[model samples]
Target: MARAGLTAKYRPQTFGEIIGQDFIKKILSRASQQDSPASAYLFSGTRGVGKTTTARIMAKAINCLNGPGLEPCNQCSSCQQITRGVFPDVMEIDGASHTGVDNVRRLREDAVYVPMSGRYKVIIIDEAHMLSTAAFNALLKTLEEPPRHCVFIMATTAPEKFPATVVSRCQHYVFKMVGLEELTAHLQQVLEKEGLEYDSEAVRLVAARGAGSVRDSMSILGQVMALGGDRLDSGSVREVLGLAGHEVYSAFFQSILDRDLVEIHKGISLVLEQGLDIGFFLQEFASCWRNLFLISQCGQAAREILDLPLEEFEFWLEMSGKMPAPRIHAGWQMVIEEQKNILRSHEPSLSLELLFFNLAYLPDLLPVEQVQIKSSESKKTSVQAGRAEKKSPAPARKLKDQPKKTSGPENRESVPAKDLDWAGFIEFCRKSPDADESLIRMLGNCTGRKQDQTLVLICGQDFIFDSIQKNGRRKIISRLAEEYFGPGLRVEFVSNGSKSNSAFRDEAMNHPVVQKIIKDFDARVLEIKKVQDRPGFPGNE
Candidate 1:
């Protein structure tokens, strides 16, 4: 006896045997049982959804000697011949191989002959979209008005490729993908009938990997059975499918929620050791966060929305409850951003590691409500400390009695602004024996005043303050002040918001390089922020 594959051995022979296509089954059954069937039929759907199978079953149903009915009697010679592909009255043609006009012309000529053995001659054309335009044109008249004893059935994954005239002449039925639950149940039944020891998780995984195709699921099951022997488990299925275990995702997500950088690093290392594709891992990680987001919102209601098994849904629900929605949402966004970068990167593993580190610190960055609450609490603490300082009189009195002078500089009000000329100081800096041009240009936007021993220079722009705050620039300014004024004169730079700052920012934005960046990225300059003395600006003092 010849060994038949699972897909062939389990091929549906009757409408009742076909799973997950009740509409197609119902339509075909009604037509097959009728006294007068449609002369032409069109079946359209994705691969492995039983378009060709339904067409063959219809052929058998029509030709079966028992009766022209919905069910075919395999015991009948006509049905057996059709099943074995040797029926004289039934012809199964491959549209791809016979795409020429001459091939269709021969088919047209053959259509004229009456059924030799069966009541009706059935012609099933698979992949009908592959038929050439000339061939379809040649068969139009014959297809529209075939002999009384002939029935034509055409199946195609892409029906739109068929000419409008061809489609209009036939009764069309559209097939849909099988649902996950339906596929899983069918796979479980198949395994049980085969007397294989299989876990439910293994069947579920195979069903998911099939992506709503029973034939595809069966094909995967064959490979899994070959590798897993008689007993099947979720771990073996995961290994075969190159899928990360649920625990890996849980650990990675927990690290992100705790903002544990070390744990995140270890988790990434473990993932690499598993030899998982970084891009696929990141995609799955993003999906996990999305599932968490859904669970956190709807609770138990998320089970239906997620379409996952009960235990998997419960796992996600428990993880989601530990973190707030906004935190998960933020992590989801980071994973999304890094996924794009990872695709374009040459070193995906390194990119993935960096992404993990970035996600670990996401809570500390911005937009997380916890960080905002902490900031508000710190402000309250500062206010309370100020009130406490006010309640103590001894510290205030001691400070009042102490001298207000310091060795560096003094903050005295009894001074004139004109006494310390900023322009003259810049000119002096320019003529100095060891002068710096950048330092001199920065001093142009500043005005100074003599406050006791200190020369207080107020800068119009934050950039000017940054330039002067640098160690080299500050030493140069102090040296110039001492040389131009007195030996004890000290220089102090302060940033004060001014209209000139906006003008400078606009001028910088209009520069050629910045304009090119804006044009290339379609970007806009939002604002020119003032640089604070303590934190300052990036890439500056």
Candidate 2:
């Protein structure tokens, strides 16, 4: 017979059918096959990781007439009835609903009795954490030594609430949030079985919004299917689910970079017109914005840092360059502030709108560092201004600070340098693979003194040099060495060495070019990291 709900119809009948709990599956399957399954199992994890499902499966397998085995023979009457929740010997209780002393009393009374119809009596209590103190005290005796044929299975999202007495008596099985790839696969199966038409993007979006809960995903998918009737396209998925479209977010990011609030509002309006969730839009937009910031900030390859399809990867890759890191990081702070404050206001749209303007001219807005930079830059500008240059009062000192460089070597030593001119080395680097100055400066962290024929640069981490080697760009660094440093000027990257003061300090930020980059990008120094070019990984000669 067809199960009533989607969860029922999609429930795992066999061990392999269960999703996102491989570790639990192995233990349960082995124990069941040996006919030595643990009497009491403490199923703990985040919601919808199949704690209850495993309990029910264990119940069915143990009472199975043909054999209490790993794989239940669904054809058997005992297995079939248990699967349908009609088995005479099995009782599934919700601790949240029946959490009083009376409930435990009733269970205590029922325990001594033998199995009425099947070989074993199984009680599966869900949300077991909610049972009252009296209920737990009352449950102690029976749980310690129940009838030979009786077994107890408890499931909870909050395992911490249960008394130490209760946990000591049972085997503990933890459920975890399902991995994205695993959840995505499970969703595809559901869609295929339901005859739902969806693309990879739609699938990924659903899985992400699901947030690692199998039941949650199924429920959301169910609601979405109800809204769309049958076929779930990405557009309908976004619409019904009130999800902001990726393109909409892309446009919003572009607007922010270009400081075009008109385009930003237009994008926001498109999402709102599509009946998007206003609060959710801000949340997802913020997240999407944050990811772009990370990618831009890190110069992380799309393929290396993110797991996305070609279209999606390309979208981020294109935006990553335009936004840059510091700007994105700065924008991220503004968005967060807007979100925190918006919760109190009655008009979320207006709050976000004002926020848009705030972030728009934010580059012009003074950060804490701008005062010092202003004092210095003003002196330089006034001296330059004396030579017949006409400008509108130097744009009102919109940029704060002299960038990192204005702080001088002492102030800037705390940050990475921006535009350090490495003489012919810089011009030479611009033509090579690691030409991006931002990247080149980060590479400087690995710089070391020449040891004989080779320049032994110790990378703080192997992954940095490993990454360069993988991109086949190591040759570029080698070529630059040959051009500037000389022939056989080997660039030997090693790991497992201590970091340098210049690398960790913002000395580079003191450079004139570094100051310009800070002003141009309108970014602030947050944190810096150094990677060692160690041996073995992307190993060297």
Candidate 3:
């Protein structure tokens, strides 16, 4: 009943003693009773979910001084030595510090020696993904044919980074985050043993904050109780933790569903004033959306979706119906994107605000029925047409045409395409809004091939150049021609070009870098800007 640490007070003594991890307990229990135990094991999961704790328990179970059984008797020397982590044979090394080949070479030299006090020497390595390539190669050799009196236990939070060879040679066990109910029940036992009184809601709040780690839950309880006096209330938990209130999150979400940016902005400002980490706030919002989506999809039984208190679960169940599936799914994606931006951006608040306004304009982007209007000018002409039902009452006679504004062919001047400035032409193309980085590259590579007075664009690659035109690049070309030349002229492209453009400029203008450059200059590129006359000047609008 007395101990120096809290983990020691609750550390499981046997397979059956471990709570919230019954599945892992069963596998280890059977292996302790088997004729041959595996040489190496890989435990992959989030931290504080009993990976290292279970490894110590399994080591004691196999090497107990008494009879070898599924559970180790703590009275035995093997159990006591392992429980305190003082055993010479069972060494626990931190992979983060000892990841070099030289350190692993020393391990290889010691691995050959026989166990002095136990049946087999067990090595538990934490954070195995941090191991160097050479260290992994050395371990891979040992895993191929392990020593007769040796066993290896590797634990990591990121198994995807581990080498395939090291993973292939070991039996892997993935540890899941403990559920809410199990964590709450376990915390209740802890509170009662410590002689502290807590309501079910208070217990649930501590469990939820633990975020799936029992160790963290106990740590949180210790922090809450350190305030003194034993009356644990919901307000006290909320005040001490300073988390964004559940109602705040719920209300912000309702505002999003209703497309009310004003309500959402007010809620965001309130949370920011509390000095909360914006990244964590975004993560919490995403998590809340995820739970609501699950509740909406799963109906009543969704109560078991996570470890919320009954009151909190009821709140989500009631609120889930107001949000539609498409909206929820899009919100989930937007939240994830916003979280990423929060990490990479310097202005987290501005990013969060932009993310909310972006949600208001979603239905516009979704595909809908297509309406055809030939052009802006053509749309204007159609609008000017009179009512059709009132016309054509008598014989269908045609009206006389009006006089033409210009005698075009006599006065028109040809550019001749021979003296065209390649650099100047590319600068004009850069002004086109329809031209993205790739299309700009294509234009830069064009050669001025003229058939008499006509300028034909000769692009080096057919496939790359054609993507712009087939994908409706005419807006860009028309804009370019109007700016650099005049109306009634067109640009045509051919597959191969006779010259090359500098790749350096193209490489520098990739979309992300271009955005940074625009921000740095605080100026729009000339090509994308409209050329208009001054209001008071002659020939001006």
Candidate 4:
């Protein structure tokens, strides 16, 4: 005979039958064994972890024909009726549907009556958090002081949603998620009893997909068993769940670790070609990185943290050794920071590609220690060069002895403005406290020459010239020139011709957008050229 569905077939009838949550079992067992059981109980945990089931078991344990005991005799009429959900004394109410005060009021009225055929009247409310505020207040009086014959048990996935007053009136029991090992063992038992042929790999996959929900795991296992004929394997499980195998994530992590762009491209393409959800793939990949991180930090103990099959765990352990903690952290951080953009993007495939592109280049970023060492080396080199200059005094003496020669652009200098290195002067302005970044940038891009005693500034474009000439900038520039080149020096401004497209190219390179592109793409603007004659084609001319 085909076995009944595992969930219903193996539903725990007694505390002993429950798979996980030993602590809850102990509490309930002790309470039932007591002569005066708590009137109200609050059971809180994630879904499918036996919250509601425990409520029913509690109901039976108290009213068992064998008398109040830790174990319910299922053969007893009260136990059988409660199990069938047709018992008169045992009432199961769904808080989601009866959220109004009227529903609670009706329940309150009904709860006053004594047990019809059993020793105690049991009222169980599922999803108790869904009760409206008014409903909870209505139930409070009945919950706090129900008749001696009645008991109230409330089961909810979220205890936090309940008001403090409501929670304070009841004894609370917290249920924990079923462990992966326990869940896997449970599935194995079910498959064996059903006489189904199965691979351990398939069982592991179903357990993971269950995510601590026994009901969900049974559902997944049932589906896989039904579709996979008599035999279940990892391939069937992955196909049914529409999930990429561990190999895919392994390939991705390896590619990123190796900084191999080509391999990364191939891996991502393979993922896309398989029609996996990009968002889900990213989340899974991040989980893999997290696993690797744990492994690197925790060593062999990482097995406890990562609930993967032995093969997958071994692979992760191997990978964990290959990638250092910092690089893994950096990579994982990038994935996390970009998650919002990737999900909101219209083209997730392209986004994934770009994300991997960045991951592939992570090795190019220097670690802090390396950067500090390089900086120290550069400083040492500069110091050595300075000492070498000091050791060679002959050139300096010979230069000082030579007559100061003046040739082209002579009159511009008291220090000829031409002889004044414009680049050096711009650097000085950059270091100056009074000169802001904008002014320094503007000066850096400008070409300077001498016209009599005036320093004539030729800007690359009209816009640059206009910007600098705003406010009292002309006066500021003149004052700066006088300070640098002496009392008679003055400043004049002019713009390059509009037809000169190369106009301001040097200064324009400093624009924020251009700078961002250079920084993000590791690129630069080598040359800026414009057509000298717009009216004629270059080739024909």
The top-ranked prediction according to lDDT is 4
Tens-digit lDDT string for candidate 3 (364-432)? 331110111455665355434422322211111111221123456533244433323444456556565
After superposition of all CA atoms, the RMSD between model 4 and the true structure is: 18.9
Clashes of 4: 3
Show where candidate 4 strays beyond 4 Å.
1-4, 277-283, 294-322, 333-347, 365-541
Candidate 4 C-alpha lDDT tens digits along 304-411 = 777678888889888865654545666787888788898899987789889888776654432111111135567467446554554211111111111234565433
Please report the TM-score between candidate 3 and the true structure: 0.62
lDDT of 3: 0.68
Error of 4 at 511 (Å): 22
lDDT of 4 at 111: 86
What are the runs in model 3 whose C-alpha is more than 4 Å off?
A: 1-5, 253-263, 277-280, 287-325, 360-541
lDDT tens digits, residue span 337-450, model 1: 778888798987788888788676543331111111135567467446544554211111111111233345543333232333544556567788766544554454455666
lDDT of 4 at 275: 76
Model 2 residue 320 lDDT score: 67
- Which candidate, 1 or 2, would have the higher lDDT against the true structure? 1
The per-candidate count of clashes, in order, stands at 0, 24, 2, 3
